[model samples]
Target: MKQHIYPLRTKKLKGSIILPYFQGINGDRMVVPFIFWALFPLVLLTGCGGNDQKPEAQQGPPPKVKVAYPLRREVSEWDEFTGRIEAVDSVEVRARVSGYLEKINFVAGQKVKKGDLLFLIDPKPFQAQLNLTQAELERTQTKRELAKNDLARAEGLLKAKAISGEEYDSRNKGYREAVAAVRAAEASVYAARLNLQYCEILAPIDGRVGRELITQGNLVNGGGEATLLTTIVSTDPLYVYVDADERSILRYKRQHGPSLEGVEAQLEVADEEGFPHHGRIDYIAPSADPETGTVKLRGVFANADELLSPGFFARMRIRASEPYNALLLPDRALATDQAQRFVWVLNQEDKAEYRRITPGAHVGNLRVIKEGLTGQDRVVIEGLQKIRPGVKVSPEQITVGGEQ
Candidate 1:
């Protein structure tokens, strides 16, 4: 057997050659052919490996995100405002007659009805005055009766020529003076009676009474610079006063056709979440205020349970727009780019696309999309940070407001 050697000329193997099947004389040239045949498959595979890697290197796993179609529902837009609760009727209870406050007839901070006795000023002085007026009235009546009898006799005497015309005229004049005096006495008596009645201070309105400003045994001047006894405020129906900007007022009037009579309103307190109390717009100021450039508006709410009270800080919303079909998206799906608002919508290729939208009033966790979106558009609600425009996403379809 003759041994032969040859160098492998393949780029994969560097400067090495191995001849395992050299059993002939002068086989150096045969070594090259033999090595090529043995390594041909490997060369072919190396070239194909580049092609196999191209697909994976050019592709990546899609970003996982949660998405859902925009919600479609009938929605009405509301204009929100900050306001305060006011009482429909409020009265300051005052002493009507001057005297010592002898008694307080009502408990403080309690509900009182109209004509309910609230306080008692000392009635003794008023009663004494009444009695003196009554006595004077009786005396005047007696004198007038006597003067009438004298005038009748003088008239009969004048007819019979038993007295002069001047004497008869004088007698009639005396009677007229007596009659005028009696009328004055009667008026005094009536005034005295009215004063006595005023001694018993009564509630002028049905309402909740405040703390007593003048307690029993305190001297209270009445009928002139009357002393304030307490305050009463009606509680059944409450007024919510709000000031709206001039532009907003005009918009509301335009949308509602210049009549706000039936426009509905809702109210929520500081600790409340949504507007739970319902009401109607009862009044809108005809003119806007020059200083604030806002119009005063008031809404009336039924407060039969007395849960609402005057002076409460409240959030109010007026239903200014009519209900219409609207597309809505979760607030989490919304994105803001500078001053413009936008959202990532899933295109047909399952890729994110930036879409600018006009947002309207917020309803719960959803926002009203006034434009730039349809009900069929899939919006990315979660995993927003993991994807951007034109990025492929693995979307998991979710129902709006459903558990993720």
Candidate 2:
């Protein structure tokens, strides 16, 4: 058998090669050459199928981001608590003498000074009693003068021996009885005078007065079962009462001094913004309440403008720690992952890296970094969402107070 080799001609179709069947010179079919010709195109196609030279991968420009070094400054931590406004001096004005309420001397809600008249009970009855006592005193005085004259005569008679010793003793006893009567009358007059004075109720303290509880012309029961006439509370230099938990109290003792004498405090009311009133801790309960596990604290503030009032719902913050150097970052730089908090830190290679940090109270617009960061660390402040861990970044340096 003679082996015949067919010359394979390749035609390129687009990017592929194609082969056509060729007839043999003899009437017999040439299977071997046809097979070779069919496979020739495949061989050529396989050889030229893949380019050894691959196009370089297109790299994107590094994401632009704003970053800054952590701020290093002295920071003080504050502990906040719910509190209430209280007056330094509060009084419930009541009538001391029973009579008809003749006048409400002070307007409701008006500021009054000490010794200012607040109410007036009808003085007619008290005045009449005083007059009666005074008249009795005058009569007692006449009797006392007569008794003294009689005692003088009795003493002279005893000295001259003209009257019996028993008679002189009797006359001296009568004079002593008249003197006792006069003393009793004088005491009654004093009491009557005091009752008349009490009819005019005077303010015991300087404060703003509440509405009159007993109006004019109403029968008022005084001294024995005194009727409440009004209430007054000091307007300036108010007191604020707050309850602090055991943990916070202990922390305060550890950070600040044991004594709360000068510990500074700031307060804000429900309708107010940031704490505008400043004060100092003036009192601390000697013992903690077992039921509530808290200690009572009192602060004094100057409310000269009368903006604060007693019984106001207030939010108070006490300085618990002294100012110390701390690392701080903008609040925007912080990120939360499940239960953990982290920030994107720019490494030496200018790549974003994840760093878990412990956060603390906010100081202005920045948050104190309690842990996991240092003053030298540069953290991404803006464009946090645009990058991820280990991604290259073009960090634009910014000042610490730029956004603050």
Candidate 3:
């Protein structure tokens, strides 16, 4: 090797070293300097090691979710329906005789018993007519008495030949006519008496009366189209009319042997919470409505306090099954996939698993589970949207309260 040293040129550009090229006469090969080789590796290694490294981040624990076991209870399934209150006996009070209404004897919305006076028609005309008929009846009775004496005399005259046969026959005929006249007058008297009694309109049923439609001094028409004076509806024992679907009625028939008589029922009004009023199925329509496919039903209830009124909208529930043990779950826990309803249940590994369920009636806030659930399975009630299948969860067990 020639011991001749060339002028070295170097640069430190962007943390990398640049070397000047030296041409040798032999040009056997161009080789990089040892300093450049060693420094090139150092540059690469230093470049790779220059990135600021942060401590590896710590992963947090699994997401927390609330879970609960299914509520097992004894429940009586009931089929609910919307209905209306009706009266057992409803009557329209009207005057029977045409006359001026003299007095409205009952206060509007008052309780009245059968035979209680409700209205008073003018009785003067009827009374005068009755008196006239009675006087006429008395006159006919006197004439009958005189004719009877004459007939007796005529019979004696016929036997003794004191009078001719034609005269005796005439006397007998007069006596018969007089008796008929007396009977006719007596019949007139009875009719007049009935008319006089009709002047007072009385309650035909025990019930609460509505507001009087016609006021006092109004002439009430007593003929074919009678006046509607007021209305009365029985209150002690009332009825609830419901139109039940034919399908449900058929299901009930299968359970109760084709007759729904005496089937117990419960009811609640529009503003009520639960079914507090109790009654029984007193009537069921013999046929189903073709248009709506519903059957009519009537439930009779005791209204001792007269709290329930007719025409009130109500919800009625009829027992579908007796009390039996069943599993229940929260309705909010259910997840839907098109037509399917599913839920996320935790397995022994604390991982979420999908489950399909069949739901029955709704008891309070809980849904009766007809199938696809066991009491041992822990179901995710809260944080359902935050989880996926096989994802681990930190479950906090909770207890459900209130009615099942």
User: Top model by TM-score, which number?
Assistant: 1
lDDT of 2: 0.88
For candidate 2, write residues 1-404 as lDDT tens digits: 98876653344466664544444565433334566766989899879977676679999899999999999899988888998999999998888888898888878899999999888888989899999999999999899899889889989988999899999888889888989999999999999999999998999999999998866899988767888888999988999899999999988888666778878999999888678889999899999999999999999999989989999989889987778888888898999999999999999999999999999988867899999998888899999989988999999999887754
Off by over 4 Å in 3: 1-60, 156-173, 402-404
Against the true structure, candidate 2 reaches a TM-score of 0.78
Model 2 misplaced stretches (Cα beyond 4 Å): 1-64, 159-173, 251-259, 394-396
Cα misplacement distance, residue 3 of candidate 1 (Å): 44
- Each model's C-alpha lDDT? 0.87, 0.88, 0.88
**Each candidate: RMSD:** 11.9, 9.7, 9.4
Order candidates by TM-score, high to low. Answer: 1, 3, 2
Worst 10-residue lDDT window, candidate 2: 23-32
Candidate 1 lDDT: 0.87
Superposed Cα RMSD, model 2:
9.7
C-alpha TM-score for every candidate:
0.83, 0.78, 0.81
lDDT of 2 at 371: 97
Residue clash pairs of candidate 1? none
